[model samples]
Target: MSAIPVKSKIPADQQLKISPFKEVIKPTVPHKHANYYELILLEQGGGYHQIDDHQYDVSPPTAYFLKPGQTHCWNFSCIPIGFVILFREELLTRECLDIVYHLPTTISLSNSPSLFELAKQFCQDYRIPASQGVLNTYLQLILLKMNEEMATPAPGHQLFSPVYYQFKALVNEHFLKIKKIQVYAKMLHLPPAQLTSICKTASGKTPGMLLNERIVLEAKTLLSNTHLSIKEITDALDFSDASNFVKFFKLYTNLTPGQYRELAFSRQQ
Candidate 1:
């Protein structure tokens, strides 16, 4: 099979985004791509990259998993030869993406030699002719490696961390209706405060932050990918009105709905 062509529009059917960047591409400053999950396989050179608030040295064999809406930067590094795969959480079998979610999303390459080697091999395989039927083979191997890592026992307080992953999965499922933190608490059978504490322990973010991040990301996707107006986005996100939705978007992104649409559309042109 020929290498699948790079797509202009992100597809809902595909569970992954795979592509290579070459020839000294200078990407913009640190920013987040809302609503998609990213797995990057770095095959060359070094630079500083930030995942959320954590910055790390990027080098060969570095693999980073960035969750939806987390801020990141490639501008800190020069053109680093690599392949990036961005997929929606729903694309994978629950078991596959779930294993990835269990890992610290912002992992440093130095911490996991096994994962790093797998990422390197995946990159090399990705660059081979798409007909090699090798892409699926390597991708599966990487997912298997992730599952292996998740099953290992780690020291204190980490074993129970899976609860927060479950909480995130629940939020992804219910974010449209149950925006309130308390609703998630009730659904998960934990007190609201206790749920918040668990989220903080596992993801270094509060429950409310996690919920809002998903909503904001979804809002951005609707705005960019559809012809929806501000009112529609407001309704889709379950906000009271366009005004409230605008306020929420601004609060997190510093961009109102109109401004965000303008910027996102401008990029396409």
Candidate 2:
């Protein structure tokens, strides 16, 4: 079995890109991106997009957000026409980062003509090769508008504080090796209890739960998309042994790694 492919569509020196979505003649294989965020707006299309474990239908005037390290693929029945915006996290401000982290993975822009117009301008500006400051301003406006257009508030949207987003970013960066809430709190220069309160207030989940969720997400991605054996995955994830990894996985998903992989493959077929 082959390893899952990691694709980088953007050039190395460039930190941001905007362009029209290219037509796909066939389904794309499962793949992940590294160290970038992608926003795909579809004005006209048919079929569905598979992002990690969820599959969302590609209705017209819809938007999909892809975060770094998340696996996704596209299956289009017809050509898709819209804009694709890719940018490194460094391009975003703290406020933009907060919005990006809280925005729903799938959004319906049917009622938001302004967003489509903004995307059109985004493409135009990219063609002009606008200054980085200009492009960054446009990206921030887009995120703010999307946040306003969400039909319903994302989970914990009201309670989200800067600390929460900071904690989330840290967890994403260190979850593979660090699992303790105390360590995360110390890194944040806060006490464990204070961090716990902030996380709970912001997301309605404990710090430990969030850490486990990130680990599980990575485990599922590897199990479903990569050819690594169970032992290999266990080691990659820093588990002490295969048996312990299996037990931990089963505790969260009720399915062992092998079983989850089989189910994921069967669905693709």
Candidate 3:
């Protein structure tokens, strides 16, 4: 398969950029962003946005989170007024950006006024002649504010310590290859029992539960967002075979992988 074309509107010489929504009267080409993250805060507009294979309506007081390598495109009746924050992983590590990374690609924010106000401040700071440190502080504050709102209990947020955060970071990298909690525990230099205890104590869930959830989540993401077949996604997710993967996925989701994908596409239609 051909690789998805990726691009960033950010200029060179800056690892982080804040872009104001200029009037976009034309349809955009489908593309992805390599090795970076994007947060788009929309204040007012009505249109459609395609992120990966999922189509989302573009409504005001909403936000979108695009992780590195997510294919997306947009069309609008008129340009939305808002700001888009783009930064590379080097600017914010996987562990540091846990809050942003876990958020869904599209969300109708509950608190848009405060977020828009912060965006305005960030825009002002970008143009002012100030110390880079001060400018970075503003950037961090904007993300922190977003994180605060995202921590609401509706989604059952976990307050991550260093160890748990590191564990999750490692899982994000190795879950496709290493599904066993014992292996992850060994990699973290902790016994399997100890890892389970840590996970249970911190999040009221076992290490296996966390690992399996991540695996299932990734499988669902691929199934919902790509045209890969069952055998293909099975191989991509490191399952033993398509049958094994089907049973495992059905065990958790109560739906066959094909059923899940069809339902997802049906919703899109």
Candidate 4:
């Protein structure tokens, strides 16, 4: 069975859902949210969080912000206590989205005891009167504080340019139809060499590699979440044929489509 993309399942009329990490089952199957962001306030846990292709060790007392459409899975060694706050894209203020929650980041919040308490209060206080507004306000506070925690630059390395953000935006939009770096470079109005330089400098990968990352992410989601056969997935993804799609998936993931699907599903069990 393929793991289909799960759109947020929180009941309608409510824009937020908060839960604790103990409630989260282990080895969360690889999946993506089609509509919302998952902000995990993991105060206690020991494991690895797989976001897209990057695996981050779960250092207790860390805050993880996952953007929409990104795939993730969890492998925690023990039951952890923390709140997982889910919010739709619209709930975030424009400034918050653009500034605070632009990318997936996990940083230790152990030093910010007050911040942790605030999150705890949010989870506990949501059942009280005006909970929605209260939660929204709490979310805003959490984002702002997390922004401060993330503000420190990594020593000796600079974050990528806003240009790379533009590139990724284009990639997210057209990864299905456009796979070539040249097309994306032209669209960005940079020469291929210039585009390559920027991409390599920013992410240590070529624009072409980033393009493939997006496609493969979607492919993995489909394989794990749906029952569609390889041929159907090929057609759904606009591939010329099943064989070509298998070849493409294998080149990046080192596993054939069938193998990947089985592996992801087995872990879900």
Candidate closer to the true structure by TM-score (higher is better), 1 or 3: 3
Please list the C-alpha lDDT of all candidates, in the order they appear.
0.66, 0.86, 0.74, 0.76
Give the alpha carbon lDDT tens digit for every residue of 110-164 in model 2. Answer: 8888888888888898888888898889888988888877986444535548888
Q: Cα lDDT for residue 201, model 4?
A: 88
Task: Order candidates by lDDT, high to low.
Answer: 2, 4, 3, 1
- Most lDDT-accurate candidate: 2
Model 3 has a clash total of 0
Candidate 1 at residue 265, lDDT? Answer: 70
lDDT of 4 by residue, 1-269 (tens): 34455566576566787766665546777677755667888767787887765678888788888876777778888777788888875686755655543544777786687887887778788766445677788888887777667756222324526577678878877887887888988999899999889989887998888888888887876777678889888977779999899999999889999999888778657
Q: What is the TM-score ranking, best to worst?
A: 2, 3, 4, 1
Worst 10 residues of 3 by lDDT: 151-160
lDDT of 1 by residue, 134-187 (tens): 665566566666545443522333345666877887887689898788888888
| CA displacement after TM-score superposition, residue 18 of candidate 2 (Å) | 0.8
- Listed per model in order, the count of residue pairs whose N, CA or C atoms clash below 3 Å is 1, 0, 0, 8
Cα lDDT for residue 201, model 1?
A: 77
Q: What is the lDDT of residue 218 in candidate 2?
A: 85
TM match of model 2 to true structure: 0.88
Against the true structure, what is each candidate's TM-score? Answer: 0.52, 0.88, 0.72, 0.67
Candidate 2 vs candidate 3: the TM-score winner is 2
